[model samples]
Target chain A: MSLNVGVIGAGAMGTAISQCIAPNTNKLLLYARRKEICDDINEGHINCEYHPSVKLHKNIMAVNDLCDLKDVDVIFLCIPSSVMRQTMVQLNDIVSDKCIFVSTAKGIENKTNKRMSEVIEEETGRSAVVLSGPNIASEMMKNLPSATTIASIKKKDLEIVKNVLSTPKLKVNTNHDVIGTEFCGIIKNILAISQGICKGMGINDNAKFAVFTKSYNETKCIIEKLGGNRSTVDDYCGFGDIITASTLNVSRNHTLGIWYGQGVYLDEQTGVLFEGKNTTIVLKEICDKLNIECLTVNFVYDVIILKKSPKKAFYALWEKL
Target chain B: MSLNVGVIGAGAMGTAISQCIAPNTNKLLLYARRKEICDDINEGHINCEYHPSVKLHKNIMAVNDLCDLKDVDVIFLCIPSSVMRQTMVQLNDIVSDKCIFVSTAKGIENKTNKRMSEVIEEETGRSAVVLSGPNIASEMMKNLPSATTIASIKKKDLEIVKNVLSTPKLKVNTNHDVIGTEFCGIIKNILAISQGICKGMGINDNAKFAVFTKSYNETKCIIEKLGGNRSTVDDYCGFGDIITASTLNVSRNHTLGIWYGQGVYLDEQTGVLFEGKNTTIVLKEICDKLNIECLTVNFVYDVIILKKSPKKAFYALWEKL
Candidate 1:
């Protein structure tokens, strides 16, 4: 059951995922776009930039070329969603035909609104496995107790990915609802930003959680409309991740929302990429096309994108409640 | 419609609720059992025992006699669940037959496991509206924006109660799922304690939220099995209150779980009532009777009532995850 696993990207998530699965895999080839990071990882056995304190597992080998992943049985695409399609196209050309792709990116393709897995399948002609949950990369790097949900069309692929990913300290739940699993990751960003906006606006607990409750239910509705089970929204990727991102300060999207809520708008030079801003725009379009009304999405859209006053948007939201 | 309103119990919640509805009512009579609290509220325009800083509305009158509520059109029973039945029986003998009763207590009857609404119905032979949400009394006292859910069998009663309770700052949503609304309040205590136990045990965020996701789904399952709609758990009472009590320091149930999780057991002589302890014992019995397997319930039961090691119980729970 020991498989050759390739993890694409050398960012915090990529390094952390590589560390988590290295013990279970025969060889974990982590593909870093930068030659320097690969050299650092291979020579010193440390991802010094992301995780400096801990030594990398012996089974993990960092590679600068995507061709090094050709022999891998599984590839975890931990790259950003903006680059997911291009990376998948390159990996499709290099990797083995039997290699199962796992998507950890949590965004829909801008304009086309295709999910990461959809884009991967269109490019690679294979259904991609989706991984998501309340997994903080720092916590995962430390091997603190964590759990995640993985979804795929093929049950065997799910079993293989589950085995590759799960440890006594890192639990993995498997399901067949790819749409629900992927969208949970996307929708959670909106939830995080919405909660963050309320927090930044100094909204009370009762009102904040009430809006949050509405947002949570609206998520189920959106997922169900997209042909996924409503019950899937109760899984780790949905309830667990939404709460983690919205309530905790770990998420960049939540922080972005907080800044907008407090009337401090960051310019493009801020350096932090907020996936939620893109998500909010894409989801608003999706909801409009589908004739669905989500107050949470509208609230975030009004405040973040339209640059409307948070108080005015909040008052409008309160009126509907 | 300036209705005559009466609020029983001058505790934090009762006083806060009275303060919220006082402006909308013709005469808001807040009933306190103690003469001293009533006198203080009446003479000083404040419930000194519960809300000292906020001045009581001029329309709000503090009364000590149950008979004082006889002329009221609506009565909000904000007393402890332990004394709910006897108080309902006493009110049944005094209040007008047309008086609408609102049960704000969030606990079930000890032996019968009857919901507060059911107990009020059994004692008074009248349907009682149920009120619940992520309401923090201290926040509500400050006229902070808050929201709540109210449920009753009669649609007319729902309308009347909604109008009586609704304010610009206090938003109210109405539903017909009395069972779901009541149980959401009852089960949230369990959720709060479960999350608190994880916090006290210093379990990682991923595992804690993963278990919380399970408990939340199990709540929907239990409610549906008890003849309530599963979707009701998505409402303010379920999602809102669960997050509020579990995450915040406002709930005594959560604090109790933290103590047990930390292995610092407090004697019963400590004045604070851990309603969640009674709820856990009762819910365990109920789940056993209904043949429902809830890991969250079992984990809390092991750590608190059975005095089992938190580490052992957590391991058992994680194995299932």
Candidate 2:
């Protein structure tokens, strides 16, 4: 039997999910925030901003309201992480209590200081599974195989999510440790930015490779110390996602790092939203309270967010190391 | 003044390390069993087998006699792990006492079933340090800035090794727990081979991503069980090396996996003398004896070494999982 799938946020990820899930299942709906994005996808059969290659299925529905997602068996929250908290607030009012919600967005709420899954559970009084990994929407839309982890503290929800999403072109492995998966996704950005800063400082490729390796180890260290299962950071969501994000241009965070490597300011490099920036903001505060070794991340955070030169921040961090 | 360095083996790693160190110090020697290879490197100034782009320094002598390496401050064992047990006996007799030693070779010694550093200490009375983490030999000679870990159980030796190896392009970081770093390096090869098997199965990128992430977690689990500190793997030698080995084509282990993915037999794909292939043999034996739940690695070992078909291996593995 085909599973019912609903995607909240008709952005790149939502469209990508819709495209990925549509070939197998009949019930697919893409809920867009703005009337224009909804109309745009419905009329043009593609998400212009995220995936131009995606051809919407005839059975797929594109709607502007959250009410459209009411019947979905699996609801994937694909919107920006910043707005996810508020979006869940509205989703609580509209969506069914029993729906197996999933999040594709990888970020923590800056104001509420909540991960997407945490935000969802708080707002809707239900824990939803999270789907995240090295998912570049463009590659996925083209039918390139991609993998991610579907993690939830709740095993039943995770299995349900794994069943619905575990298809050939896309696979969602199950993990009970949501904190590890979420932490990896958020913390990866900080290191990528640090790598970018190092590259900008005329550090050669070996130096870059060294930093890349250390950053991964350092991030894993931080994750394991925070009561996360060590395995959580070892595999797909943790290592694969982190490596893919920091190494390739596919990641917005990594791209910002590359720009930072090229001596561009964080604000100028992004020109769009990056959740790792906010994650870094919270990360610094968390490090101070937790007493973790975070000068590398702190250095990049200052250079990118505070408009400091990459050099000054880099020297500061390297000196401490 | 920097210590004069002697790299035993005169292979890919030995030559590369010699070249990288020679640019900074006058004391560089390459030891080999074959007169021709030593002669070619000394006379022709090229490492024909390992890295061809870089030239051998004039002061760096390539000698077939172990007696030539006696005056060196540090002698690096760059031989394969499988043969290190037998080879170390010979080296133990030839090399001087109180000489600092390091190892570039990665693998668990098959017979004694020990890490490279342990093998060095067992064979020779002198204790050893590890030069590990993402230190791709040829890449380092290109003057690409690279960083790696120098680790010993002894803090004083670790600091001494770290300081001597520190150069502008080749940086050295320190980690105290070698059991973690060495285990991370060897176990990751087993994971890389598994990754290859997955690629051979035509799994989606997401599945691969998922598997890759999970593989590390499994590695960490085994390492922790082995009584290695998490911080060792959490630093350059553990997680960093895994990322580099799994992702880069420079690693023959990962390449062996890529060949496995392409439907070639393990021996045919590896073309003999691949460390990852030997790693498969050693890891499977260790996991089986220890009752470690290492399905991914064990499954690959079953397929590649035990003559099971890839499909058969997968079915058995999936069932157990």
Candidate 3:
């Protein structure tokens, strides 16, 4: 079926999502909050903040007003988790009810600790699908092949998403375990930061790999305890994304981990959105509320919250293992 | 308990394994076929081929004769899989019957398709323990922290091994699933090569991550089908080792994959003994003989054996996923 697609947010992830959807859809709409981003995409087919070299498809229309995308059949919510609620409220005031909401955002809300899809469904009053994976936006802009998971409880929505987003370069897999998949994406960042600490402590690949395997196990237990399928952590969004983010130096989380390893603490005070650091705080809160003991999570909390030295934390973790 | 240790082979892995055991043992004996290597370690306190920088412990004695290790309490079989049977046959002719054998070898035997532990038990008439992990020889030589899995059917032997090998720099986890753990170590090389192909083709991290997740799933299924624990593949030797080998550019298998991606074929004719290349053929053979269909293994087989182009094989794999 021919589809009218709209993407919210003009950031790197938003631009990449627009490029992925642009070549296949009948008409593509990009609603950027900033008029300059909208004008730039509309006039020059570029989003310099995300990708400076790649030229976007001509069919991608940039719009500043949410009302301009009311006719679209699907809206890919690409805005940050901090602003997701407000963006959804604005779209709900103008967009049609039939439009399917698919989120590319990879985080839990600050106050409610709710996944982005939950926020989408609550605000928009529509069933939503969440897409997450080891997708680095810069690579997508280069048309490099990558795999992602799209999760929705509804079978029909999954089929539609597969039909819309699947391309030679972007392979999409469908999963019904929305909670498990979302949690996997969120927790992997914290694991990457831990790995960075291992690197900073001058531990070899062996220790880093052990930490990775243990993190996956620990994350799986936490997810299963929370009523999500454990196998979902073994999927692209969980294992795949963590491996990619942890190994590549370009990731913000890994960078934060490197700094953490070097005994430098980074917080919101740095004006950096190191999602793993924030995720650690949220994850620890959830674990405590749920009364589950995750050793890796606890160790991370000790380092990030209790101000334990990275070397001391590493040795403590080794002793525990 | 005070233990006397003996290590076979003097290659990089053998040397590193000897170094790991030497610092903890009452006395360490290294059996090297090359007189120069034995003399180098004993007289000069250096294993030039494996580790040139680190000085070996004074208690570590090197010998060129297999009979010199006959009185040792335990033997760490660090030989290559290609010569495993031959080496075992030689050791059996001289070593005592009560010696506990711990193997650091990490491949399935070529012609027989048996694991090193299986060959060890058959030749030595004793229960065997196997060790595997993301323990890169060079990294281990540097005394950088790393983790390894030590698996044995006997609980007492595992404890003894833990006492003998566990050091401040290297962490060892115990497991009872010998077959599954060994297979995990053997198959990870093939996965590394596949990852290298993704790199050579310039595929993005997302696709590579997806392929990795799929490969792990496929490998786990194959192990379970063969009467091994499925969770073993998720352990340090399986998941952790693959992550280390595949992500890093220093691995031989990844290098082979890179060459394959560039349309450069690597084989024994090229004077490179890439374990992953040999493993793909053996794994495909095992799957066919067992009447099990592994899509990832089949795709790798087609790429290596059927002379299918790497790009086409990659696309075929994506289509299957």
DockQ of 3: 0.65
CAPRI level of candidate 2 = acceptable
lDDT of 1 at B251: 89
User: Could you arrange the candidates by DockQ from highest to lowest?
Assistant: 1, 3, 2
* Tens-place lDDT digits, model 3, residues B1-321: 678999888888888877877888999998888999899988898988778888877878899998899898888888888888888888888878778888888888887888888888887777789998888888787777778888999999999988888888878889999988888888887888788887888876677788888988888888888778888887888888888888888788888788777887765676767777778999988999999877678766776667689888988888778
Q: What is the alpha-carbon lDDT for the whole of candidate 2? A: 0.73
lDDT top scorer: 1
Q: Compared with the true structure, what per-residue lDDT tens digits does model 2 show for residues B1-321?
A: 777778888777777777777755657888888988887887888777777667777768888888777777777778877777777787677666767788777888766678888887877866688877777776767756567777777787776667666666566777767777788778878777777777667755554665666576677778777878765766667666776676556667777776666667744543477777677887777777878888777777877777577766765654443
lDDT of 1 at B296: 85
| Runs of candidate 3 exceeding 4 Å displacement | A124-127, A265-270, A304-307, B302-308
Assess each prediction's global lDDT (C-alpha) against the native.
0.92, 0.73, 0.83
- Quality of model 1 by C-alpha lDDT: 0.92
Which residue pairs clash within candidate 3?
A146-B207, A147-B206, A147-B207
Distance from true location, Cα of B244 in model 2, Å:
2.1
Which residue window of length 10 is worst by lDDT in model 2 chain A? A264-273
lDDT of candidate 1 at residue A168, scale 0 to 100: 92
Error of 1 at A220 (Å): 1.7
Top model number, TM-score: 1
Supply the TM-score for candidate 2.
0.80
By DockQ, the best candidate is 1
Per-model RMSD to reference: 1.4, 4.6, 2.5
Kindly provide the TM-score obtained by chain B of candidate 2 when compared with the true chain B. Answer: 0.90
